[model samples]
Target: MREIREFEERLQVENTSGEIPGFLHLYTGQEAIAVGVCEHLSDIDYIGSTHRGHGHCIAKGCDLNGMMAEIYGKETGLCRGKGGSMHIADLERGMLGANAIVGGASPLAVGAALSARTLGTGGVSVAFTGDGGSNQGLVFEAMNMAVVLQLPVIFVFENNGYGEATGHDYAVGSRDIAGRAAGFGLPAVKVDGTDFFAVHEAMGTAVERARSGQGPSVIEAVAMRWRGHFEGDAMLYRAEGEVAELRANKDPLTLFLQRVEGQVLQEDIEAIDRQVAAAIDEAVERARAANPPSAEQVLTDVYVSY
Candidate 1:
């Protein structure tokens, strides 16, 4: 969680200073959802992520330097600096790539799940989508397809209060992503995304069910984002002090440390914090020193013609 928080916080600074280019979304407040769930997955499993995907990439074990360089548009990045912040992918890591389009990756996850079941690979696929994305027709279709096919997929809806600037309360017609999932024949559960244990337990149940061939499930993690949807967003739609209140009372990292004070030593936590910070600093420096993709490399990764 600390690693993800630090990474996104650094991205916020870098994006503001023009070191990072293009549309960048931070996974600031919702660290636990990614870490908690991904703690169970392995390279045999797969995950499809959303536009706000930095956390998923980190939790799924993508290299930090590559991620930083990818965001910086450097040639050494995970996608050779082509995919940038929204589309970091590593097939060997089972990260199916982050989608720039909302709800886009859900179908891709379904495809992965289909492949897994067909190949008898025992791999479960996860689709991480936002509250706003839950409204898309593609997401619904993906859910229905998973249920019908009995695919080993988990629809992880990271319901981060708002989708962009619009509150989930206002935008989601069902007003309950989990309820909607249940309607699609998925055993759905809503967990407190801020609570790492809760998300982990819920995800464990869903993962077990999928791996055991009980079919697909849904986990709607109600985590709230600290920043605006994108870096430059004014966030004018929010009430004054709303974000501040969330940061103070609902910070997942602080909550995690508080909850695990006895099990994890304070000095150990501090040591980890320092290490994460230093590593992030090094990643940023390396990205700064790296070269951007030359003109010839632009078309290389875009398509695969038969």
Candidate 2:
């Protein structure tokens, strides 16, 4: 929770700098989903992210400096600044990349899982998509393929109520996202995404199922998006007092702090907070001082032996 808060603060700083190029998506309220799922994963396990992916990157052990640099469109960024905020990637860390296209990464994750299965590697692949992407045909296709192949994959549906400005209630036809998983002939679980323990426990089961060759499972984590869909959204679509109420009552960071009160010392958590703040500060400084990509470099990577 503390780490999540720190990430949120860093995102705020990056967004406020007015230097972040292209679309910027904030994961203020959905921290638990990323942290919880990644808790059971290792560097060998692969995970795919969405546009609102900074939290996922952070949770997956992405370098804060590189992420900040990418957002700032610096030459030293993870994607050499070409990918910007929506397409950051770190193959070494098992992050395929953050897909700008909705529902784009699910099939990629399935492919990774299929490779893992065929190669007899113990690694697993996870697909992190939101409620909006869940409606896409690709998600269903990935689910069916995963189940039929019994690939080592976990489908993490981060249902944050709204798809951009549109409400999930209106966009998603189903009452329960997990119920749809049953159609794929896979076991599914629905959890409170704001509660770290709940997400952690559910993901633990899903990961185990996938790793043990029990086939793919769907985890629908019901959460709320604290910030606007993107950084500059007016959020007029949201009901009055809805966001405030969710922050006060259902914030994942707050719930995790409450649940782990005794297990983790306050001073220890505070130390992490301080460290994360310093890291973010250093990242911002580095990004600001770094140079942008050269014009010639763009054409260089576009072709093969041309």
TM per candidate: 0.97, 0.96
lDDT of 1 by residue, 1-306 (tens): 888999988888888787777998889999999999999999999999999999999999999999999999999999999999999999989999999988998999999999999999999999999999999999999999999999999999999989887899999887999998899988999999999999999999999999999999999999888888888899998899988999999999889888988898889988999999999999999999999999998889787576
Best by lDDT: 1
Shift of residue 207 alpha carbon in model 1, Å: 0.5
Model 2, 5-109: lDDT tens per residue? 676667676677678778778888888889999989888889999988888888888888898898899889998898888888998899999999898889999
Residue 197 in candidate 2, Cα distance off native in Å: 0.9
Considering every candidate listed, which one attains the maximal TM-score? 1
Look at candidate 1 and give me any clashing residue pairs: none
Q: Which ten residues in a row have the lowest lDDT in candidate 1?
A: 297-306
